[model samples]
Target: MDMLHFGGLAVLLALCAMASNMIYNHFYEMVEHHYGWQRTVRMRVVHTLGFEAFFMAIALPLTAWWLSISVVEALLLDVTFSIFFMIYAFCFNWVFDIARHRLAARVVADR
Candidate 1:
């Protein structure tokens, strides 16, 4: 594919990622609230696994169809991406939670 095609694909993936993040967080937070589950290590691990699994389910088939690759190949690629995203999601969520807490604190302090 050309650079333009790759660029478009990247944009689509990014949009999908954003949408998934929003949807995942909504439901995840609901569960946390219902269960009173804190963001402990166990909850983080569950979050990472659930998020990646949800993403892979949507992405793997799209990737195979888009790239004209076999299911096995797509699964392999998805696994590779999953490994990266696992660490990335863990760190990203950790940092985001910290930043959000700080912002909320500032807002409350200013009130």
Candidate 2:
């Protein structure tokens, strides 16, 4: 296929990924609140790291083969995104935990 087709398809795929992630944030918050999984700082850290590694493992080979790029290059890019998301996830989950607790406490107090 032509570069134009490849580029367009990549853009479309990225848009879909963005949409999925947006939807997932709601479920992630719900899981944290319902299960208390991310209530502790330590669990949040581990969860973020595991998430990053999981995404890296899934993305590296598929991206390399599909883009016709070197495996090493794809791995490097994947790692970069993984690291960024790891830190982001940790911070976001931490804040979400605090918010979840406060909201829960408020609800209990109201009743």
> Could you give the C-alpha RMSD of every candidate to the true structure, in order shown?
1.9, 4.6
Q: Estimate each model's TM-score.
A: 0.84, 0.65
* Tens digits of lDDT, candidate 1, 1-111: 788876776687778878988899899999999999998778888999999888777777777787788868989867777798899999988888889989999999999
Count: clashes, candidate 1: 0
Put down candidate 2 lDDT per residue, 21-55, tens digits, no spaces. Answer: 56556666577779866356776776666555555
Candidate 1, run of 10 with poorest lDDT: 5-14
Best by TM-score: 1
What lDDT score is found at residue 21 in candidate 2? 56
In model 2, pairs of residues that clash are: none
Q: Choose the strongest candidate by lDDT.
A: 1
